[model samples]
Target: WKQSHDKDNTNRIKNSTENTSTICVSVCVFLQTILVGDSGVGKTSLLVQFDQGKFIPGSFSATVGIGFTNKVVTLDEVKVKLQIWDTAGQERFRSVTHAYYRDAHALLLLYDITNKSSFDNIRAWLTEIHEYTQSDVVIMLLGNKADMSSERAIRREEGERLAREYSVPFMETSAMTGVNVELAFTAVARELQQRSVQQPSEPRFQIHEYIDAQKEKSSCCRVF
Candidate 1:
């Protein structure tokens, strides 16, 4: 049902491998996941920490359009490749980012625990996700910058309560300390993997698009 809009672009995308931004690897399954939140909520940092195993504070610029990266993670002995898309949180980029939701397999919505404004914006982000994404897309909420607990403007109980109200899994993560960074991703990936196992007849991937590789800016390259 997904990728219906871009079926015509598939062949051309597959042929142009040299310019693609995704880390191409042969895997049994692929999952398209996206991270959404207000700016400076540590979305890019979290991705870098999860994908690169280290966090470089202040090294990443706000994603101009989108930031793309992929990693192969093993779950239950099955190799699952996660295509992670990071979107710019600015209002100017909202339209550009909304187009991505339709094809995503899962979404990780992040908020800064230290900034109450970011937490307040979560409702708006969730509204957009519901408006654009499919009904089956897995969703998770994360309160980032947990290392700065002293500066936290939102408490863990508030996060947990909001997650309960929304019925999506929630966790507190610190890109600086690598806390729950991997676990959050693993949980999402596991759900996707299990879904695939259960629905063997459904398409394993939603869409395939290749984004030109660029430094300091992300292009939309999706494997699933």
Candidate 2:
């Protein structure tokens, strides 16, 4: 009788495990993050580091229009897929690249800390995001090349000021040393997850409109 009872309990446990897996899969959510910045700011390099875990020096080739890769990550016991798009930063590619920005769940705006001009162009990039993406889209400003502090051209205070002005989170990272790169992405994922939980009734299709409306409200407040 004991042997028969043990077999029954084992089968019940197996079934329970399967049911749990099914429930988790049904609730799993995915997000897409687009990385944008002026050319030569290490956008592609940073992505390659995160996605592939390999770095190729002197492998700098201009991204033609848009390139993408996907990664699966687990955050707070939830499995999430991240589809990352690396876009070309050239002026001529703007028209082609606009579509990639539309449906992005988050944006990582990167600039070289060693180059003052790249740091100064943050406003232009923000304008592009506003034009192409919903105003509620999460934006993270990243100062790259943190490994080259000896050659730093842009002060940390300046980057922080702009990030505050735009109401976005900011961080300094080094694709070479791999500093704060992962943390920046994790912060974005957490923000997206929190938003999803708070507004469970909001349909995914209406997210863009919702964000745009928020942006309009913020802009109106600034005017007054």
Candidate 3:
């Protein structure tokens, strides 16, 4: 009778362990979304507002290479952990910034609504995406600072046209007023969730290993 009791107790402990593992896995769906754009387009500000619900003004310095933040959000009854990366916009930092782009589940391509040059540079960003990601990567074009319509240089139609040309989603948003910021991220989360449903076995994350492998290969070739 003692042996039988011991066996039953062990089974209960095993079952409890399995249940705990399942709960941990179910509570968070890891998703990586990257924000990329020209300097001064408020990429950092938008992320700060979304993550903290507070707005900070003034001449903030550009990101050096890449900065990351994590937040948990619920979509369609599933809890998801969003890992957001804000990359530097300077040309000299492109090499370092490109390392953050690989395997990203979604990319937010931001542009200042009041800066025509920033809008024009969207093509360059698209080229970068094409170089590192698959066609399946979710790309969203965001016209930020939409509150400054008086200073707006890129019209809504122009932004929409580019988005259509690239076959990506587009939206106008005001980070300062908290307009459409949540919606933009929600749309990205929804897209990722849909993709996850379609591809159940594959997880969504940045391809850090792939970048590391490429760097190693380049260094080896240089030595040869």
Cα-based RMSD of the predictions, in order? 10.8, 15.1, 17.2
Clash count, predicted structure 3: 0
lDDT of each residue in 143-213, candidate 2, tens digit only: 99888889999988888899889878787877776666766676677678767776657654333343334
On residues 171-202, what C-alpha lDDT tens digit does candidate 1 reach at each position?
78889888778778877887778776776676
Whose TM-score is greatest here? 1
After TM-score superposition, what is the CA distance of residue 102 in candidate 3 from its true location, in Å?
1.2
Going through the candidates in the order shown, the clash numbers are 0, 0, 0
lDDT of 3 by residue, 1-224 (tens): 55664466467546644654565476556677889999899999999989988788884798866677777788779887777888889997787667657758889999999999999999988998889876677888999998898998999899989987987778788778777687678677776775667565766543333323433554322210
Scored by CA lDDT, what does every candidate get? 0.79, 0.77, 0.77
TM-score of each: 0.79, 0.76, 0.76
CA shift of 134, model 2, Å: 1.2
Among all windows of 10 consecutive residues in model 2, the one with the lowest summed lDDT is 215-224
lDDT of 3: 0.77
Candidate 2, pairs of clashing residues: none
Please say which candidate is ahead in lDDT: 1 or 3.
1
Any idea what lDDT model 1 has? 0.79
Clashes in predicted model 1:
0
For model 2, the superposed segments whose C-alpha errors exceed 4 Å read 1-27, 199-224
